[model samples]
Target: MENGSRISGDRRPQVGVAVFLLKSSSILLGRRLSSVGYGTFALPGGRLEFGESFEECARREVKEETGMDVVRVEILTVVNMVALDGPDPTHFVTIIARAEMADSGQSPANMEPDKCAGWAWYEWAQLPQPLFGPLEDLLKGGFNPFAASRLM
Candidate 1:
């Protein structure tokens, strides 16, 4: 309910879109500054707006968060996370997408300093420590963005 959504009676889970922006042998990640996952590394993405297609959400979020355009946007996987132990008792349906930079030479900028510390390209095999919950779940579920991208 951090986004102002009613938490008292709303049992519906929120939908989030996470993009794995692959470039050469690395993927884009940013250190989150949000309350839910502060200091955790996560992909460039946000809540899936109403009436928005998955691809649209992917492209829009990447642009909004990183100030970089993405291409070949495609859904790679989905994750269902239910954290009932916390006071908020939140649930999230995360859609994971894969994409490439519109311009390989274009570097990412910290578009939302309040939400993320900074952005960096990290190799898949050696991601940063303390990954976002959804991202950790994705990895545990064996969803490899690099392998998925090659198949697509």
Candidate 2:
């Protein structure tokens, strides 16, 4: 524990992808069960694997967590998280991206019951809380996941 700047043993910062899986004007939010962001509503995402691209990670995480196939994934923003509030100062570089469901017939079903309650869509202004750190930072930084007219 580096006291909120970086993880204790790992010197390299963690890189991850958070998806804004959209349906028309609404976006998907999942309740987190991880220790860092327990009980918070945030986008479905996780660490970037060794050889995968950002879009790949987004699609994989979305499908693995929410059981929904996402298509047309695109990068929306890059978030630099420097956590300095707890016993361990952790730093994470998160790639915020967007995508739409590959099939209208498909719906979200929680795949990782241990990590998520379920996934639901919400208007950007009506998103649930308490927000995850990267999500809160993205919101405070004026990042908006809406505006996907194509989804509509």
Candidate 3:
């Protein structure tokens, strides 16, 4: 087996949890510094830890990446991503969750400078160019965070 493949031959996709942290008409996004999606705008999220629920992962990731406490975390959608073209191809089952800041007046801080450039809020209709692949996939699938949040 290759180094990237599991010894047990398990081929299950890894799970990632992302938050759509909404503040009025804007949502939080950060420029990624990671190799996978470097320079692309993405929501705060990471791999779901063992035994952790989706909501728990969302809150933890948001806090870890942006240093902000989130509330009302709810699952909005799930995306099955298969990237077979890259040098290190991957398959990720990404969970998209919606949340709001616990303190409405609070702003995000860059908790992990190594992972993200910085955090900023952008209006849904005027988002930055070059979104992360999973996020772009989610949007292409017609998953509107604003519309979905309203139904929650």
Tens-digit lDDT string for candidate 1 (113-143): 9999999999988999999998998898888
Stretches > 4 Å off in candidate 3: 1-11, 149-152
TM-score of each: 0.89, 0.87, 0.89
lDDT of 3 by residue, 38-145 (tens): 999999999999999998999999999988898988898888887766566678999889987899888899999999999999998899979999999888788888
lDDT of 2 at 25: 67
Rank the candidate models, highest TM-score first. Answer: 1, 3, 2
Candidate 3 versus the native: TM-score?
0.89
| Model 3 Cα shift for residue 151 (angstroms) | 9.6
Compute the lDDT of residue 97 as modeled in candidate 2: 87
C-alpha-based local distance difference test score of model 1? 0.88
Please report, in order, the local distance difference test score of every candidate based on alpha carbons.
Answer: 0.88, 0.83, 0.88
On residues 12-104, what C-alpha lDDT tens digit does candidate 2 reach at each position? 689999988777767888888877888999899999999999989999999999888989998877889887677766678998888878997
- Candidate 2 residue 89 Cα shift, in angstroms, is 3.1
> Model 2 clash pairs?
3-88, 3-89, 4-88, 4-89, 4-90, 5-89, 6-89
For residue 19, model 1's alpha carbon misses the true position, in angstroms, by: 0.1
Clash count, predicted structure 1: 0
Q: What is the lDDT of residue 89 in candidate 1?
A: 71
